[model samples]
Target: MQLKPALGAIVAVSMLAIVFWQQTHLDPKAPDAEFTTLSGEQIVLRELGGQPVLITFWATDCRACIEEIPDLIALHQQFAHKGLQIIAVAMPYDIPSRVKQLSEMRKLPYTVALDIEGVHARAFGDVSLTPSSFLIDRERNVVSRVTGRFNLADWRARIAAM
Candidate 1:
């Protein structure tokens, strides 16, 4: 009985440490992450110089990520002509085939890429959480980061301001 209590305490402490680490990982300015688009073409961050860019890291099996797709799609359509560029990068653990399939099924009106080697995640401070996102201004500076999901109204306002 005593051992069980001690183990539980240890787990709780470990969980706290993990949470702290994840918090510390937040707030990083996204680096010039390179992406290979589904069309086998490469897009470097520096190339998107004159547009507000949204780089979202997600996984096929992540419910929150999936839930945010429609909103992202709509937002892309609403803002693309106004210089908004949305890029969705699949998490390293997600199957490339599934990611492509989902992208097709949803008709994602944005660039979809597979981060099979985790380079994109590392470029954004080794983000391991699903639905993580970085919002960059026209000058290519990261202006916002969302770890789980974004509120639609708030997202639109931010993009509008960009």
Candidate 2:
């Protein structure tokens, strides 16, 4: 009976440590992967180091991803002129034609790339979930990584700070 309490306490402590580590640790460098935008424009991550970049992995069928489109567009409009670069990358399984059509329909005002070969996704820690996002600072260091929907206002403040 005493062992159960002790084990529970240990587990709680380990969980707290993990949460703390995740909250404080940031990736030293963003991937130097190359992205081929839907319009055939090539973008290299390292080349855009002197500006804040938000890279989001998404899919056409994901409702959450679709819902965040407006927030992304807003972010682009608010910060593009201020040196914020936003890239919306479609997942490997997403059809290229669908991705293109949706981008056109929604009039996404940011760089949109398709990861048909999954190379970009793999380079970014094998992101298998939709709506995963990473914020890289001007120094090319990854400052934030979120795997689900996030607060637009919070992200806005973060970018503004960068």
> TM-score: which candidate is best?
1
Per model, state how many residue pairs clash.
Answer: 0, 0
Roughly what TM-score does model 2 have, to 2 decimal places?
0.84
Tens digit of per-residue lDDT, candidate 1, span 1-162: 789999999998986675467657655445777898877878888888888999999999999999999889888989999989899999999998999899999888899988989988887877787788888888877877777898888889999998
TM-score of each: 0.85, 0.84
Taking the tens digit of each residue's C-alpha lDDT, what string does model 2 give over 36-114?
Answer: 9999999999899799999999999999999999999999999999999999999999999999999999999999998
Point out where model 1 deviates above 4 Å: 1-28
lDDT of each: 0.85, 0.89
